[model samples]
Target: GRQGSRSVPQIIDDWGDYGAGVGQVAASRMAYRYAWSTTLDLE
Candidate 1:
């Protein structure tokens, strides 16, 4: 599954509002890393 065009905010928004729990924080970190990696690959 390639989501290379999505920004971090867009990814988070897609996940919907799940409140700020530990899992949400971890997921955000993972999404941020995924987005960063995808951006690097695009370059």
Candidate 2:
């Protein structure tokens, strides 16, 4: 479902790098969207 056995901080650290490599605003928006969608789907 998610990534490896990393904590939330670790995950966000990776996300920051990935986001920076891509596009900061876009990557952050997408990450938030994905997180919200996943939570809604789970519910």
Candidate 3:
């Protein structure tokens, strides 16, 4: 979703709150998927 979790100060500066919100949502989704896949919890 995001272009890697790398910090893009320039983009944040350019896109402002809207860009930050999109990135935040994307990063959170990616993190959730990763944790779910890597864990061994059956439930």
For residues 1-43, what per-residue lDDT tens digits would candidate 1 score against the true structure?
4755767897797666655566789999999999999999999
Per-residue lDDT of candidate 2, residues 1-43 (tens digit)? 3555778898899999987877978888999999999999999
Tens-digit lDDT track of model 3 for 1-43: 4766646796677689788889999999999998998785755
Candidate 2 clash pair list: none
Model 1 quality (TM-score): 0.53
TM-score per model over all chains: 0.53, 0.47, 0.55
Candidate 3: stretches off by over 4 Å: 1-14, 40-43
Most accurate candidate by TM-score: 3
* 1 or 2, greater by TM-score: 1
RMSD of 1: 17.1
Global CA lDDT of candidate 2, please?
0.88
- C-alpha lDDT of residue 24 in model 2: 71
Q: Residue 27 error for model 1, in Å?
A: 0.2
Q: What TM-score does model 3 achieve against the real structure?
A: 0.55
Give each model's whole-structure lDDT. 0.82, 0.88, 0.82
